[model samples]
Target: MSYELRDHTADVAVEATGDTLAALFAAVADGLTAASAESVPATGGDRFDVEVTAESREALLFDYLDRLIYERDVRLVLPADHRCAVVEPNEAAREGDSADPDAWRLAAGARGVPLDAVAAREIKAVTYSEMALERRGDGWYAYVVFDV
Candidate 1:
């Protein structure tokens, strides 16, 4: 998996690729952490678990990043190392609940350090602007923009 930071007029965009959905999410999460800090410590000082459910893949990406932002603000930390898994809607569930809001779920673990311990920037929010998450061939790709 890999990610690159692209320059937008005033915000920053992250483009990531992976061989699987989980890897793509992890790459993007790392990109988010990179955007928030100049450098993250090799080892993190705080750790936490994250769970988010959404109506679609795009929405899942949005909520996952939004939750990290919320965690940073509440805990005064700069989020860093991360790992995540995406659970797609099963055939049975998709056939049964057309209006299910939790069709997509993400379970993740993350590590962070105190905001004061690093040179950090403030990310106002995660936006739908140009957001994308899709499968191509046998791999996954994602793009997301962050409000700085």
Candidate 2:
């Protein structure tokens, strides 16, 4: 997985690519951390398990980033590592079995970094207006814009 950061007119833009959705999400999280210059401690002293559901991959991407923003702002959780996956609902199964509340699960490995070490301003939200997720050959790629 890989990520590239670009300067946007208002907010920062991030693009990530990977062989799988899970890898791509993880890379995106890493990209966000890199952009913020948030130092993730080496200890597994703090962490959070996050789950988000959305109707489409694009929506999932937005929700995934938004969750990260929330974690950073509300919980002071600096992402150290992340694991995410996309699960499609089974339409033919029973109602309860068919619908998974977490179409995506993001397990974030985090540890509190010194407040002074965190150099970037907080990210407010992730926007869908310019979001893009698509298949590229045998892998996948995505582009997203965030509101600072």
Candidate 3:
């Protein structure tokens, strides 16, 4: 999983690439953290856990990213490394109302440093404009815009 900062007209953008859906999610989450700060601890920090559900993959990506922002803002944590797992419908899932909650869910955990303790940028919010999450060929790609 990897990410690169791309130029956005006004906001900050990141292009994430990975071989699997889980990697893509992690990369994008890492990208969001990268855009906000620099030189995070390689490992071993406070644990950050987030679970989000969305009807579609695109929305899932959006929510996942937005949640990262929320976590950073509220908890003052910046992700240094993360792992994501998608519980398939064919596999075991946490009990919830199907009609009320979205079908696809992501359970992710991250380890990051405190934002206040690091040199960080203020990311205002995540935007839907120019947002993309899709697979091409053998790889997955995600593009997200952040209002900085």
Candidate 4:
């Protein structure tokens, strides 16, 4: 997993690339966390699970990041580590499956922290107005604009 930070016209931009979509998402999360804290130790003892569906890969990526931002703002949960599984649907509807319209499933967990301890510039929210996620060669890449 790997990611890089670049300057954006409006918000901070993050680009992540990985062998798999799940790995790419995990790297994105780690990058976001690093923007605020000096370092995120792999010692989160808490767990969180979330399922979100969108109309496109870009939307799905935005939703995934938004969920993490929600946890930061509402629950004060900052994830230092993440695990994701992309659920592929078959011709027949799968049980416990909702119409995602998109092509991914992003369920993950992270360690929790106090809201007061979170940095103010880490990320305010995940903006959908200008977000993108695309396939590149054998891996996946994503661009997220955070409200800083």
Best by lDDT: 1
TM-score of model 1 relative to the true fold?
Answer: 0.91
TM-score, each model?
0.91, 0.80, 0.87, 0.80
User: What lDDT tens digits, residue by residue, belong to model 3 across residues 1-148?
Assistant: 8899988987999999999988999998889888888677665568878998787778888888888878877777776687898654433334644544436778998886887667998888889989888888999999999999
Q: Give the clashing pairs for model 2.
A: none
RMSD of each: 2.7, 3.2, 2.7, 2.9
Report lDDT (Cα) of residue 146, candidate 1: 99
Pairs with steric clashes in candidate 4: none
Which of candidates 1 and 2 reaches a greater lDDT?
1
Ranking by TM-score: 1, 3, 2, 4
Compared with the true structure, what per-residue lDDT tens digits does model 4 show for residues 2-121? 988767776777878989888888888777777656655455346777776655556667788788888777776675677776554441146455464335555676666554555546
How does residue 84 of candidate 2 score in lDDT?
A: 69
Q: Give the lDDT of residue 69 in candidate 1.
A: 96
TM-score of 4: 0.80
Alpha-carbon lDDT, every model: 0.88, 0.70, 0.82, 0.69
| Candidate 1 wrongly placed segments (more than 4 Å) | 91-102
